[model samples]
Target: MTTATAFDPMSEDYQQNPFGYYRAMRHEAPAYFIESMGVWALFRYEDVVTTLRRPELYSSRDWINNALGEFDPVPQVPSIISSDPPDHARLRRLASKAFVPGLIKKMEPGIRGLISELLDEVQDRSEFDYVSDFAANVPVNVTAQILGADKTIARNEFKRWTADLIRSGARSVLPQEELDRIHRSVNELRGYFTELIAYRRIHPGDDLVSALVQAEEDQQVLSADEVLSLTFIIQFGGAETPSHLISSALWECFGDPALLDAVKTDPDVLPLVIDETFRHVSPVRFLGRTTTQDIELHGKVIPADSVLLSYIASACRDETVFAEPDTFDINRPGLSRHLALGMGPHYCIGAVLGKMMCGLALGMTLQRMPNLRPVADDVTWLPSPWVRGLASYLVAP
Candidate 1:
């Protein structure tokens, strides 16, 4: 609508601190096209929410396939994230059954125990990387437990596979060799899930994989490919987003003494603190969609099949939505309005699980490490266009 802007997401300045860039886009170009990325970027809260909610108008199917031209083969199994109704509806319903409230509530004791054990292992160290020592492992272990994965699958292996899979999915332009590596990682991850699914079929357990194995839709069960695809989505979604969230929440606390003191003094506000963190520093920065039909938005006409990037991170900080949008205030009113977990049909299926893991991780960290503080102001962030998270955050107790 406004004159298109040259927004380079991969630029050093944007990667290091995107909030300023996001603010600029929200002000100057709510629906501006990024010449470099070849996608129309939506930054306003209302615009992003509308685009996400109206998936019928803006489809996700093969959006990445179109964007990743000549890079690597398009994924064979389109997960729920990439599907449209009635297929999307069917897959989501079946998957939702696995993450019902009762099952997640049952996971609390195990989640707390895992957090305690991790804190114990790091308690002796004077300084440690929050991401590696704590944040990264929690979700992988939790997801593994929920999926009834073989304990033989190393945690580090899970982390590596998940990270590669996520990198492979991003719109960022990566080198050919790196893209090839990502492709190989994708195959390895698929093989792992295939083997896991086969085992679960023969020896079913009270876990998500087994549930998906038996999940029926109108007298039809999910195919092997469907199960594998869903497994891939669940593993990465459950692991990466929540891990980033835990680290981001802690990063916020460590950077603000008053915030840290508030949480340490009144742990009751831990959930609110986590919510505020999600609003202020959403882990998943943006999601891609394709225009299903030519549409007019904010005085711009986006043609059919054009790629559109809905910047959730930017929307969460929209001045129109939140009072003091940039401030990390736990008690900010109407925090639920934030689109951190997305909205409408494709709202993150793993939202509840992510919250549980993050809440426990933060609560336990504050309790166990009473003197928790950042080791340095320099934090290394994961280099990806879509995911906003630190690769490592140095901290000391």
Candidate 2:
């Protein structure tokens, strides 16, 4: 008799290093149901990819809100990440209007400057907290600059609000205090974005927010709430993942001397290194989707209305798909094939921007601090079942 493997999202063993647990699920329980969490967990690469590609069968609509058990009293605003079909497409179109390749290219110089400034602040230190001092600052500053919001605002208010909102969203269950904080953050963010949207309406600027304000579809402009929702998603999405990606890349590289040497010597390989990092330590670990109808997989029937957790982190490291799956190889062929940023209609819109930020940050770090290395093996990671990111890493250059 095969004993079922137990999995718990809140367990410290899983939180510390989930890759082993992922491997177990992929091998022994490809479609394991976690009664405690009330979700079906899919870990195999093919299973995750199929579920992501078939959004019609696996819907994202209300998956998060339902999991968190929160509903806004106000009419729901169309959201790019939380909707399906026509609504997702519409919100995506409007949001993409502001993230054109040209605009992202235009921000490159500014992004580089901000990266340099951040490094300059830490240049004199023998040791510094990589996450708080550098990694955390880059994406928030870039998001603020892109949105035409004062960078000062992002440095504090926007950063705190978005961090809390994301933390709250990543949990399987939230205590009353956390739920209250999430509510407050949501209200604060709405007010902040509403004000910015109103300002953009009167005084247009050459920034993402202004572009979003003027963006039209079928001769229809976005409603105030829609605009707010888009900005909220953009800022929140922008801030969290890339920050983690950069720090995680550094952690992986510094832990491997050969990888660190290669990254330091060859700037051209930085993108590849970033890609490998995505596969090895994906910033967003899992995404939730609700089944539209019953589905059979791995000899088990997942009933309709069931919530499925597509473990991207697991898929990226599936031994069936990747050789020596746990090893972090910078030159790994077809690294981009990993589902770190997701797949299909809900694929991350900010993927390109995220890669750019991480690449530049990693490249600049190598250039500025060639001798950079972690001060200790002990690192603090954010306690989120759905997200993977270092909270702090003491590094010395």
Which parts of model 1 are misplaced by more than 4 Å?
1-6, 63-74, 169-176
**Per-residue lDDT of 141-212 in model 1, one digit per residue for the tens?**
888888888544748578877766666656365678887787777677777888899999999988889989
Compose the digit string of candidate 2's lDDT tens values, residues 1-397.
2233757877776777788788878888999899977889898999999888888889888654754445331237646777898878887887788878998899899889999999999978989999999999999998888888888889988778866766665544568887778788777777778889899999999888899999987887777888877787788789888999999999988888887888888888888988898999988888888999999999999999998899999999988888887898876766778999989988998888889999999989989999887899988778778789997999898
**Residue 35 alpha-carbon offset, candidate 1, angstroms:** 1.4
Candidate 2: the clashing residue pairs are none
Model 2 stretches with alpha carbons more than 4 Å out: 1-4, 67-75, 170-178
lDDT of 1 at 209: 94
Per candidate, the number of residue pairs that clash is: 0, 0
- Which lDDT value does model 2 have at 50? 88
